[model samples]
Target chain A: MSKSNNVYKDAFNRCLRLLDETKSLPSEPELGTLLGVSRTTVRSILARMEETGLIDWNKRNKTVLRAPRSEDFFPEEETDSLAEIIERSFMRRLLAGGAEAGMQINELELAREIGVGTTSVREFLIRFSRFGLIEKRRNSHWVLKGFTRAFALELTEIREIFELRSAAAFAALPEDSAVWADLDRLELEHRQLASEIATRFNEFSELDERFHRLIHRASHNRFIVDFYDVIAMIFHYHYQWNKAEERQRNEVAIQEHLAYIAALKSRDPGKVDAACRKHLKSARQTLLTSIPEGRQMQPA
Target chain B: MSKSNNVYKDAFNRCLRLLDETKSLPSEPELGTLLGVSRTTVRSILARMEETGLIDWNKRNKTVLRAPRSEDFFPEEETDSLAEIIERSFMRRLLAGGAEAGMQINELELAREIGVGTTSVREFLIRFSRFGLIEKRRNSHWVLKGFTRAFALELTEIREIFELRSAAAFAALPEDSAVWADLDRLELEHRQLASEIATRFNEFSELDERFHRLIHRASHNRFIVDFYDVIAMIFHYHYQWNKAEERQRNEVAIQEHLAYIAALKSRDPGKVDAACRKHLKSARQTLLTSIPEGRQMQPA
Candidate 1:
């Protein structure tokens, strides 16, 4: 890897962890402290956010922190990259949830803490807020809203719903050029995500999330993504059970993910549908195993 | 109604509308404007909140917003009333989104146009954020995170997970235990909600969401309620399509809701499950009807 690439990866991980820890925006000093990066390097990264065009900050100034409020971050150039945005969005929320309580975090503070900049923190924050987990205050400190039981239940239900939704997207794929290209792109993402999970030793919960997200994106129905996000949320929240409960199921997941990619590569929709179901089932089992007294039928 | 009670209810709706309008915490002036009451009257409401200890206000005697980090506003006692919170939270998100987009708004905002001063909104925000839809900002403005795709998927999946969750809760109820007592308590609330929807009902999408929430509360599980909330978000985001695209399914949903209460009081678990599933299926079908275009096979 190039030296710059290695540095960027390190910066990215630092940002994710800081978000998890603080659930707020981090400032420049905090980023420098966390990533061991100079402010200059951090600012450069923030500047490159022009690619996503998500955050707002004076290009010449160093201190103002702002978020994208419908200013061209909508992905109009529009490749099948919504999946990537979704994936990135999920990571931001996870990190935000894990943020430490009562830590006075600001956009700059978050940027510093996460080794990014005020800009990315603002962009990520806007996206995170869009998902309704992180709320910004009048004074600019981050607070955690946490999840409701209803939301959790709704999220779990999405896995079931996605099966139906993916069926729709799958059917549409043959006739819709956008849908076909979306799957092909997602297949590549799944490969990269899978490789990171297997070879690079990624976080299991995140890897699992990305895997399913790949399926969701392939479904290619806009609502399919929003609609299925909660299921992913349920799975993510109960991820405490992932490594501990699904010890044996890791092998199953590997095969499921691979099967999905192979099918997508082959443009075999049947295989995609079947493999996705199997993957979701395995994911469900992992969640079930984590709960004491697994699910059973009783005449209510 | 007693004058105080009428006043309280009126104030409550005002706050609710404010919550319906803004996702951010309201300033004192905003709250007064939303309530249509003098700033003094709003202060009285805030004082009552502070006195009851349900909310801790900013100690500085400013507009008496929610205490920055107090757990009191979202007391554990109210967790079981999950549906109430879920409804308010969605309303709050809708309000905020509408406000942001500058469209489809009523003149009177809910309570403070910042803080709904309603327990449900607070609880819902906390819970939903935990699940990743609602997030807190640095300045403590509650940001309405977009979980449309994820949330819609959750609503569908939840209809299945909750049947099990509710069934488990029902089984846990001892035959002589006051499950009926709980129902009796919920009866009035349910009727009030149903009547409100039935009377002025215009939008199928909103009515559909309202029905699911009523049933979620009726099931009486805080944990399950939270799960249902995640699902409700799914409904909120996707019900638009389900209503607009699948008119027949919408009609079916209207008919099902027509008798939902009777089915619950029938006191048969299977009946309730069947009813709930049937109700959910109609709604699901409405949503799913649009999904098959991309599906790989004919949906069974």
Candidate 2:
């Protein structure tokens, strides 16, 4: 929440959008001026952008302008952001220590919105539906179904332990080829996802989901993944809930995501972990601040 | 497995089981003699154990030993050894992408052997039932479910992605008083879970689940946890088939878990992340190697 970090985020998002628009990487200084931030932050952001393969990390000359083709940005294994949103909402309770939150979303629209073919959306739906996040109803229309507020608190508790385990596991990575490669890939994925900003909250939700899951998957621990998944499902919230941010906050969020991307690209596990905690802490603060006159943060 | 590592593991387990026999800790020479390993391996294992809080890693003016008392060895809120068997099964999949062929188990008898509460048994049944790993008819008898060879391989892909997200969020944690204490407590829980030896495949699987869940629960990232949950539920393996050696690998698992615990105690994020990947890799390799002649790892 520092003023400095905020400027970095703004400049970062501006560049991402600009890249998407121009289909070319712009001069680093250009983004800095456009976002009303310093050139230094912009340069670091650009550096991070390059590290993640979102743009090639430039070399030799100072005035690097050619950005990666927009086409290359979209990976072949695209995810459904909407499905991810709904599923994430459903899981919020699980992680928070609440019962499942269920909802059926429009697969076709959700897929289109996330910029993926419908194939992946259907698969996502099927995956969560079995777990009761999506349900078949008499109306024949997909509808959202579950919510348990306790999940949020439980999830907080679980994430604490997760960090501890990660702290343990990260340092202990075997000095072997595959394990080594996985560490690199995990760091790389973090860099890439942090740079791109989804047009909508739902889409961003999915990207973020894959982003974290990629880290866990790279560790290659199914029990860790599955256990995480269960608590997550138990704590899931609906897509409707992530709607309270002020416009300024939302803008700030895009930059934070970008900064996170930059941190990951640095390939310092300590930094990524720090960024991850910072991100979660902000949300926790937001939730804390948002509590109303009669509302408190406790199991509902 | 390396001969030295196995030798160290055997010695560690012997020391672990002898908790009631000793008033305090053992010395390095004593440990070396106990397991017939060289003095050097004992020193290394003891150092790692100290880091994990399995022992007090004080500056040894004369020697290394002094494994902590039982209460110091584990937290009050953790799952027991038998439950750990089941839980660690998940750990293997979460990190390593492997599931050894488990043998048909009598749920009731297995429950009694491990001394876990019956509720845990039922929870396992429910989980295994969903994956079709176990079948419980109307009469209430649990039967081993049929499985194909491809189950472990396919599960690895999904599990890997799950941990990646976890790692990202965990790496994000910051050193602030607001939530740092909670983070420390969770870390302690992870250390306890990470350091265990599975006596049975079924128990290992249970422990694996608990260990990873402990981490996910601590992560507090709804998006990361929920997405992982839905996908994890779809991925399951029956422990009804296994060779003697793979099952025996548990002999060394305790020491490995202890190493992870040590990393967490140090709060070094890089080491922790590496530790997680290393642990999971072991699990994945186990499953990869444990596939029976006719088995096919499941495809998501």
Candidate 3:
């Protein structure tokens, strides 16, 4: 659910930057490549822009569409939701290649990079400041904060409970709802991903997120959705903590996801519960192993 | 968990305003009455204030030893978490006596009234703006958004599922955990509240929040806790729609909570689940009746 929004925020930010610097809007594939996101994300941003009169986008004319006016530059008021935009930018910074704990984030630099006003960035910084994920200095700069191993352990336990409940809910969902169709598609995708794990192990993170998101949506609860966004932001994006075993762990996770899907499809509550617990336990172990001997445990 | 934070936010905001205007700290009772919160809230705020160098205190000097410096006014940095502070003020106004849907909320006025910077409020507003609970005008003012019956119905369904999961988790918690002690205290409080329902019906709202909060804590998931904050804000506070039946409904709710606590103390998951569903069903009904004939259903 949230991954799609992150794509939009990243794509739109890239578009804004490109428009400012190069005075041109890139094609969908070009924007996707430039932003390192997905073409679907690029399309969503462009579609939203067209809806809001930010651009005159059409399938026949994909290039330019004319530059957005000054009045169209307020990012929070258009395209993605504010939480999505904020989380996307924050996760990107947190998961960026070569990113380190305790890195200082320049507010102005972030505002420019994300193509939002400094005030919008400031608003998000203040929101995240509550979580100790970032702290505003007396000089007004923000510093990235590190999580302790204990934080991760505690987080894993909580995530287990949430996922278990979500799995049970998914199994119990009426077969007639549109959710079943989505789950069918996701299950097929899961099988395909598991089959190609040797070649496409890196794609597991996105698939893992979507697989759990399907179960989460079955509950139709906004609270779970919102809270899962935080969980997804941390676990899905924080894989950079240990890149050495990424492929191996992802291969194991795909197998677990496949079994989990099989159990869910059976519509047996106990089976689904057991499957969720097994996969989540594997996930917890993988998460713990990814953190190197508490080197990242320094308090923020 | 989040309720305690809300208390601090409300109390600290009041104290900051008082110190600025009067140059003197108010006594606990005075502050409580002035802010329309509780003495516990006032004390928590003062304790945090003392810890943060916003004040000085001891058995001998129970009052502020010195006024805070001008730099101490950055609210999100001091006293309470930003989310709590924002939600507390927003819930208060939305559920305030005689407050109506579609009421125009002046940003400057709310900032002054809450004793927080307009920026803090704006940040919070933007977050809630995503939910359509509030809206930002081109002129920068905001308006209170009304929810339809369909919205409430959908929300109630989701809340039911979340609470059901929470109740089961609570029942499964080990007896050795500190949550057991808290549940004992709340159980006794529930009985006491039930005994005085005729005259103390108003107090049920507070007790109801605490009762559910204790179960919510048993899960110990920050996501559940955070999600429950939204639930508590909506259900606990949004009870002013049908004041005429308030006392009668509260009486019924008190009985339900008593049964819920009894079932929980039994350590039987089945009993606990049944009790939770019963109480939550009553809560859902009460919520539906409170909305006055679709008077507040205009989409924001």
The best candidate in terms of lDDT: 3
Ranking by lDDT: 3, 2, 1
- The best-first sequence of candidates by DockQ reads 3, 1, 2
Rank order by TM-score, top first?
3, 1, 2
For each candidate in turn, the TM-score is 0.39, 0.31, 0.59
Runs in model 2 deviating more than 4 A are: A1-149, A159-207, A213-216, A222-239, A287-300, B1-300
Model 1 C-alpha lDDT per residue in residues A11-128, reported as the tens digit of each score? 6444433433432345666666677666765665556543444334364433323343444232333322332444454455444444332334466654555445454455445545
Better of 2 and 3 by DockQ: 3
Please provide, for model 3 over B197-262, each residue's C-alpha lDDT reduced to its tens digit, 9 standing for 90 to 100: 788888878888888878876665554555566666566556544566778888888888888888
Model 1 chain A is weakest, by summed lDDT over 10 consecutive residues, at A291-300
Per-prediction TM-score of chain B? 0.41, 0.39, 0.61
lDDT of 3 by residue, A110-186 (tens): 77887667777787776565343665664237777555565577577656766777788788887787877887798
TM-score (0 to 1) for chain A, all models? 0.42, 0.38, 0.61
lDDT of each: 0.50, 0.50, 0.69
Interface RMSD of 3: 4.4
| Model 2, residue B19: C-alpha shift (Å) | 45
| Candidate 3 DockQ, CA atoms | 0.15
The CA lDDT at A199 in model 1 is: 51
Q: Which ten residues in a row have the lowest lDDT in candidate 3 chain B?
A: B1-10
